[model samples]
Target chain A: MQIYLPIADVSVNWLLLLAMGGGVGFISGLFGVGGGFVMTPLLIFIGIPTAIAVATQAAQIAASSMTGSIGYWRRRAVDMRLGLVLAGGGLIGTVLGVWFFNVMRRLGQLDVIIAIAYVVLFGIIGGLMLFESLRAMWLKRKGIRRPARRSGEHPWYLGLPLKMRFHQSKLYGSVIPLALLALLIAFVGAVLGIGGGFIAVPALIYLFRIPAAVVVGTSLFQILLTMVAATIMHATSNHSVDLVLALLLIVGGVMGAQFGAIAGRNLRGDAFRLLLALLILAVGIRFAGDIVLKPEETFSLVTLDN
Target chain B: MKRSALALLICLASMATATAETLVTSLSTYRVAINSNYTGASLILFGSIERDARTAPRAGPYDLVVTVRGPRRTALVREKEPLGPLWITRGQRRFVDQPVYLAVVSSRAIDDIAAAPMRERLKLGLEAEFASPLPGPNLMGEDFVEAFIRLRRQQGLFQEDPEGVVFLTQNLFRAKIDLPAIAPTGLYEVETILLSDGVPLSRQSTNFEVEKTGFEQATVVLARDHGFIYGLIAAASALVLGWLATVVFRRE
Candidate 1:
């Protein structure tokens, strides 16, 4: 059935929307990823206006992150101090990101920004994951034993000014760098309409050398706050958040996320990483292809409501 | 001079004797309520010519042309240029006060029915209706306008059907205009004209409104006007849904 979306001022098939939500949710659950990278692009492909798609996706991400973080909280996996610091930076970043988003939208350059951002981000993340997983697989095939090493010692940049203690993650680092990293991720999430968990997870693991167990939980916690901030900002400033669209996606997304978490347990780390890397690369390639290939119709028109 | 005066008097007498017929038209409904299931809508525009025997022969039979135009809106039309193997939007033209939707229907081909200048004066064809002001005297502005029209037509927002209007009798006629599912909600101006011998004998104009009703309207108002409450509701519902998902699926 066709449903009218108010903010987007468009009609779309309800079943298609649900399927999109479920598919993206499945990937999110399986990879422990926020799935914004997949969902935002899919929404645009399905004919939702870019502004509404970007703004509305924030609500869905907030929902999914809330569930994920709660689960981690019950298990005592979250580092409250670290999560709070990240959220503090995320709040500031979200404000700036929303401002930038509005500016680009007014100038009619938001679509290009989204396209370029996705291409660059996915290219980097997917390339790294692919190489890392492939190397690990090759090493396993060689049957070479490697010595166990500690993670926190490397990345000497962690010794920068303003050292702060994160007792739960068992790390001493400068709040400045961590805050800056959170700010960057939150800005990306706000502009891209994601939860920023994917970027944050890697940053925590590699940059700060946080324990894997704490990283996921802490990132989820921060993502929840970031998305909430985004939802409010988009609603109040841009009035682009479509509540009905968000609700519909959430219905299928919640159910799919549950099943994804269950299925994720059976997969090995390297294999899972390989699959996720492939998924990211595929989306990145599709976006890049749009830039390289001739568009079917170059001219697009939107009616100004005001 | 005496002969010319006598001829002019004869002509004036004949002109006074001959009269043109007037068209009376009305839409089936003036208001369209768009609900959740409203994919599209079609409106029947039926009209009649108030004809007299002397007027009919003098004015000839009337031909009908109907046009419906949606609210004026500004549009940005962009063209992509290849930038190092990647296509990007390098140039754009802004069109101001352009109709979002336009549908034209006639008894036959517009060109066949009326001369080009006449049609342009009447604003009966797509080109006539979309003759919006350009940004400046740029050479490429015409291309951009054409592109805008082409895209709108492709989306089915702009339509023209030469055979859409049907005449039931010498005096009565009806036409149907289809508004696509993506039709904008606003004031629509519908104009119907009666043409006799390529001259407009009579013209009538009416207006209708397409509005979001029921759940669709409510949500739009909430989002646009009461945005803070709407945002809170959105965040709260997402939180609840998330919590529910975790509780329901925790076992596995």
Candidate 2:
């Protein structure tokens, strides 16, 4: 099927749609990330109306994350109290993000803002991933036998109020840091239409210094709530959730995620991180290329609010 | 006593004949079966009608009608093109199966005290096929199958409602067509028509029966007996195969 967008004079192909869904699904399962970074660009490439794509991706994330987080909860790896608090902050942040999106739309500067966000975030994240992966590879070549460990703790997070102990995370941390992290990630999630797992997982592991074993499950728990809220908000507000498409992708993704989790269990910690880093770097480069290069043609569409 | 008995016997025979004359039209069963390779044949209702031609035959300044009635408040009516003396040419056939067009005529003008309202009667000229043209022959069978499903969706008809009345109105008439593939096959009236110019002239009707085919029977049995296992296997195979194909045909 080819759906024509009147303003852009572009047609979207169903085959491309299926491919994009499958590719994003696989990456999401493999990395414990929301894959929104990949999905938004893929949607644009395939000519989905921008706002609709964002909303639909949120719905997909909710389904995929629910499946994943349920499995983690069954394994008793989730910190419910912390996750809920973070989700509370996330909800507020998401509302702000949506408001920002509307403001940008009214200013007729959405495209520029999106372009800049993609470039800056991808550059930083991609560089970090590449550097870390290369360093791990070098360490392996030198026959280092030490286990990888969290290196540093920030004094700023330690000084924050509302200190809480998370038995699953095995750390005593200030709730303020966790809440702020959640808010920041939620804003990014709303803008990118992902569940914010990419940011959440890293923040849990590197900043909060949560044990690597529990980080995935905890982050997924947070993602599940955030995505569900986001999906509901988008659906009722924008009516952009394509239930049919979401069902198709999730039916496939749930089964794929189970297998991916099993595969992840078999990999070494360094090996997993290396693969994730490479994936992030690759995605970043792709985004950068799209921004810098001249597109085949320039097209515009009425903003979703219109 | 003999006169009364003779009249009763005549009424019984006439009633039987009347029941047999009603013409029926419907899309009772539809399916799109594809092979493991995603290539197979599918059937679509191109155009179908059972008309009671005895009462409303192809003659004079009259109209032919077709309708599809289904679940919910669903209704679609179409009318055949009107034939006039000027339209008939030297080699022109009696009827042409061209695109059906919707009737715009008001039913009140046709007959005052006899016929039902326009909504009650089957209007004609609605498009028979709901799907757009396939991009190519490779997509033909599946495309039609999808289109058929979509048509059912538009009418809110599916496994939920298996039967509905499709009425045809012109004058005092009754007919029906038993569509093929109605589960638990039995007798069905499909079509009916009324003939009137100055007075009631004649009426016609048709009948058909629906029965499950071997493929349909087998599918139903499989679904009832082993649906879960079959679905799991299909999902697994598709995932494994899709992954392998992507790996082999990896695009940089």
Question: Candidate 1's residue-wise lDDT over B87-184, tens digit each?
Answer: 77778777777788999999988888888888888988898775646554365477788998898998899999999899998689999999998889
C-alpha RMSD by candidate, in order:
3.3, 16.7
Model 1 lDDT per residue over A1-306, tens place: 888777777788988888888888888999998898899999999889999999999999999999899989999999999998999999999999999999998877788788888889989998998998898888888996556766446566777887889988988878888889999988988898888787789888877878998999999999998898899889988999998799889988887787788899999988998998898888888888777789897776666776
Give the CAPRI rating of model 1: medium
The candidates' DockQ values read 0.66, 0.01
lDDT digits (tens) for residues A178-221 of candidate 2 = 88889888887877776768668777777778877778777877
Interface root-mean-square deviation (Å) of every model: 1.4, 19.3
Reference A-B contact fraction recovered by candidate 2: 0.00
Off by over 4 Å in 1: A151-154, B1-18, B58-61, B131-140
Off by over 4 Å in 2: A1-19, A145-154, A262-268, A303-306, B1-252
In order of appearance, the predictions have TM-scores of 0.94, 0.52
| CA displacement after TM-score superposition, residue A190 of candidate 2 (Å) | 0.6
- Fraction of true contacts kept, per model? 0.74, 0.00
